[model samples]
Target: MIDWLNSTALTVFGVGTTWAEVLGFVTGLLNVWLLIRQHVLNWPLGILNVLLLMVVFGTAGLYADMGLQVVYVILGLYGWWAWLYGGAGRSELVVRTTTRAEWLGLAVAGVLLTGGLWLFLDRMTGSTVPLADALTTALSLLATYGQTRKLVESWWLWIAGDLIYIPLYGYKDLWLTAILYVAFLTLCVLGLRAWRKAIG
Candidate 1:
């Protein structure tokens, strides 16, 4: 079993890509788990996740995703501060539902942005599955924004995007990242359950 494990690790490393994918995966899980508990630590762990992923995705030629990692770092910093003090009278952020208008706006924006990102990725780059990959990437951005604001509906967006991401990452031959997203999907469900109970 040890030899088999060593062989697998060697094969993965022989591909000449960074092994930070595994590290980012573990930290990403920690980040989301903290998110479910409404802990501020999630943001710092999330920052680490994105910082590591920026390297992993950049090496894999996922430029849009690489850029998303950079954006996530910025948002993670903002989110860290916001969750700490952006609430009523500088209190902790509270879970809140999006308004109907906000929900509708997000839906429309997801569709438009998905299409736009797909076109941009396809026309501008040599990325594989640019359309599908970009669609998931775009929606995930909106979802992440909603999460940082403590929106109760963010889990829904995360679930949707992560569902799409599983196959996309699988297609990209990042089995570890694909599995990480599958775990993310499960956490999204748990996040929904936890946040709903906490908010009420």
Candidate 2:
């Protein structure tokens, strides 16, 4: 498993892309596509996406992002059940907007969590891009949590995170991963629109 995670699958432009990255790319795209359509299968695919990404990020010394994937594992399990039985009277979840209180809370948490994670990842580890990693880590948690609850704001959070993530992954020389985030950014826009329409 470790050997395969570290094995190069192919090259993009000129950089050798690892098998973990190659597979994460496929699963990540399908996971988000399913989420946009409110498919129950998104959760399971999301679990697979994060597992593969955990390897990719860890190899890059992106400890925060690697840790974020671990958290996603837990969230993925909860999200799976939530989607099916988390609504009122244990029904399928419906699309909804974040309440004002939830919005304010998420804003405050994103800021604080980024600051704290930046400090920890910088001081405690060898992460070269602690600030960017921390920022995306915070947004990712917020987005994933909101998505589990079927909140419309989740797609907004994903778009915000991807805008930061594209450059971060590229600067790290993870070309294929960077390109995947580009697609994710586009998918997030479509997701936001689709979810908004669902609420209406």
Maximum-lDDT candidate: 2
lDDT of each: 0.84, 0.95
- The most accurate candidate by TM-score is 2
Runs of candidate 1 with Cα error greater than 4 angstroms are: 1-17
> How much is 171 displaced in model 1, in angstroms?
0.9
Q: Flag clash pairs in model 1.
A: none
Clashing pairs in 2: none
Please give the lDDT score at residue 80 for candidate 2.
95
Q: Which ten residues in a row have the lowest lDDT in candidate 1?
A: 1-10
lDDT of 2 by residue, 1-200 (tens): 97888899999979999999999999999999999999999999999999999999999999999999999999999999999999999998899989999999999999999999999999999999999999999999999999999999899899999999999999999999999999999999999999999998
